[model samples]
Target: MLVDGHHLLYRAHFGFPRRVTGSSGEDLTGLFGFVALLRKAHREHCPGQEVFVVFDAEDGAADRAENVPGYKAGRAGADHSPVVHLPAVKQALDAAGVRWLEQPGCEGDDVLATLAKLAVVTGREVLVFSGDRDLYGLLDGQRVRALNTQLPAGRQLVTAADVADRFGVHPVQWPDFRALTGDASDGIPGVAGVGPVTARQLLAGGRRLEDLPETASGRAGTGLARARAQWQEVLAWREALRLNAHVPVPDDLLTGRPTPGLVPAGQLLTEAGLW
Candidate 1:
């Protein structure tokens, strides 16, 4: 199983109901919530599964920003409360013997994609724990599934069939689907008039943006026709949205053994002398 380190941290910091503090009154909500969530997920869904946590590097968005210019611009000005707790979280993870990685200039999504692909090719099933829809592109039936704990219990494990059933497009076309509809989270402004229904219609029949008909009539077709003026930009957005599954990761990272269950958050912090 692969965990999105920063994503989980942010989720824990902001979405966790109550504030948590250390003995010195320092905020430890992010650390506590992250460990608690990971522990619960591991105990319930993937006990004895090998877990690898991947964090986005400081410049992880640089490559995508150069391509799209506006990719994730909003995040720059957003609250960074979760970030201040990252060091403590890392310390706790180390104390608990949970192996985590952060590759320079690579996003956690891409690293997880690379790891998931490597695992699948090696005849191992993979589970990616992240709420980021961009990783949905990595879904390939039972071989690779995403664990979005933000979703309700039974629906957390998202499969390619689930993507196809919910979005009317295959998992492979997720980037294309998001490119047309625009991702507010990533700050990509899609075609002015195109929306989800139109986007879905354009990508119907498992077609990519490049595979769309050049000329057509009707609402969605006409929207596509109007969107042709910015077709190259949309293609670029799709390219930016696609996960790089070929990232260079160390071969020795995995030990090929099941990971032991994670200890509770408070216990880990105490053992690490972080509190």
Candidate 2:
């Protein structure tokens, strides 16, 4: 199983109240929630399967920001007090024998994607845990599944068929859809006036943003014109937002095993002062 560490922790930090703290008098909402989520995920999927937690290294943010000046700019200067105990979280995971991967110039999503792709090639069942909808594009045969945390039920299991049913387009067309309908969260400025409906229609017609009819009639026509005009910018942003799985994974990083042991939840809570 591959876990999007940053994505899940970020959500946990904001989803709960600010009162959650650790033994060091530091805020532990994110840490506590993350541990719980990890335990739950371990129980629910691949009980004895090996797990990899991927974290975003600091270097990648600069590249993403450089690619699009406004990419994730909204939270650039935000305070991270709520997640101050993240180091403890890492230590906890380490104690629990969970292997983690963090590579310079690569985000957690990239690591997750790379690991998932590798698992597919090895014919292993891979489950990705993340809240980012963009990862939906990675869903495929029984070999891979995406567990999105933003769904109404707390998680949405995504497969190839689920992708087609939910978005009316195949997983491969997800980037195209995002390119036409901007994602405000990611600061992707998609074609103006083109929302999901129009984007879906254009994608369904088998036309990329660059190939849409410029002066045609109806919503599709207007959407095509907008897409054409903003094609370059949108494409650039898409490239920026897309996770690269070609990142070299060091054999040591992938094969490292944690010291075997179970981290008692009570001990973790007490040491962290959550008790």
Candidate 3:
């Protein structure tokens, strides 16, 4: 199972209250929340054979910043002073013997994608845990499944069929879908006039951004044409937005067992002073 560590951690950090803390007077809400998530995944999937927690390397934001100055720039100015027990969280994970992977230029999504692909080839059933919708593109071949924590209770299974039902496009076509629609969160400027509706039509029409007709009429056609123009920029930016899975995530980084530790939870709690 591949876990989107950054996505889950960040969500845990923000979703829960800030009142949780460790014995050291450090905030432990995020750590405790993450541990709870880990425990849930362990209990449900029993993927004890091989499990990986992939984190986004800090350096990846620089690449995004270079492409677009506003890429995750808001986080740069956010108030992180209140929740500063992250190092302890890492130590807690280490103490628990959970394997963690990170690559300098790639985000957690890329690492998860690469690992999922490898798992497919190796005859392993892959389950990706993340709240980010972008990872939905990786679902295919019945070998991959994405569990989105953002969905409603008992509706977290985001399958290939779910993608088709929700977005009117195939899972593989998501990247193309986003390319035309652009993602404000990631600072991707999708096709100019194309909204989600038009983007879906273009994708449903079986035309990639570059292959769409230049001038067309009707709501869908006009929006798609504008999207085609915007896609020109998206095509160039897509490379920047895409995750690089080729970067070697050393085996040493993932070296560990999945045994649960008694102190891991309390250590995380104490480190952040949630105890």
Candidate 4:
């Protein structure tokens, strides 16, 4: 199982309203929730699976930001609650003896995607745990599946069929899908007036945006026509949105070394002086 480290950490920080505090009144809610989440995933979904967590490097998205103005710019000004607790989260991971990695220029999504591909190539099944829909693009029916522990049905896996059923696009086409419709979370401004329904229509029949005529009639066609001038930009967005499944991960990392046994959540907090 591959986990999106920061995604789950951020979710845990915001999901819990009660502020768990330490001796100096420092917030421990994020730490507590993060540990609990990992424990839950371990007890329920990870008993037999080799678990690895991937975090986005501090400057992971710098390239994308430079290429596309306003790329995740909003987050730059947002509250720091989500990342402030990361140090503690890492501490807990160390306590649990879990495996994780953060490369200088790679986002967690790309790292997870790369690891997933490597795992699949070796005939191992891959399950990605992340709240970020961007990883949905990494799903492959036979080998890869995505999961969001934040969901009410936390253990329910998202497969390629689910992507097709929900979004009218195959998992492989997810980047293109978002490129046309725009990913609001990342501040991608897709062609104005183009929405999911139209984007879906344009991308139907396994035809990519470049495969279609630049000019045509009707809503989907008109949207495509209007986007031609910005095709290069859109293409860049597609690349930005696409997960780099080839991020150089070492072969040894795939061997799943024996992690130290997990420390109980209560013990972890008590040891950290948060209890």
**Weakest ten-residue segment in model 4 by summed lDDT:** 254-263
Tens-digit lDDT string for candidate 2 (155-264): 36778778777677777677778877877777777888988888888877556555555466799788887777766787887787677777799755545232333345
Residue range 60-143, candidate 3, lDDT tens digits: 677667765566665767666424655655666676666677778777787887777766776777778887888887888568
- Candidate achieving the largest TM-score: 1
Give each model a TM-score. Answer: 0.97, 0.87, 0.85, 0.92
After superposition, which runs of candidate 1 have C-alpha atoms over 4 Å from their true positions?
none
Model 4 bad stretches (over 4 Å): 213-216, 257-261, 272-275
lDDT of each: 0.88, 0.73, 0.69, 0.80
Prediction 1 TM-score vs. true = 0.97
Model 1, residue pairs in steric clash? none
- Candidate 3 residues lying further than 4 Å off, grouped into runs, are 47-49, 79-83, 251-264, 267-275
lDDT of 1: 0.88
Q: RMSD for each model, in Å, please?
A: 1.0, 2.9, 3.2, 2.0
Top lDDT: which candidate number? Answer: 1
- What is the per-residue lDDT of model 1 for residues 18-89, given as tens digits with 9 covering 90 to 100? 989999998888889999999988998899989889999999999999989989999989998788888888
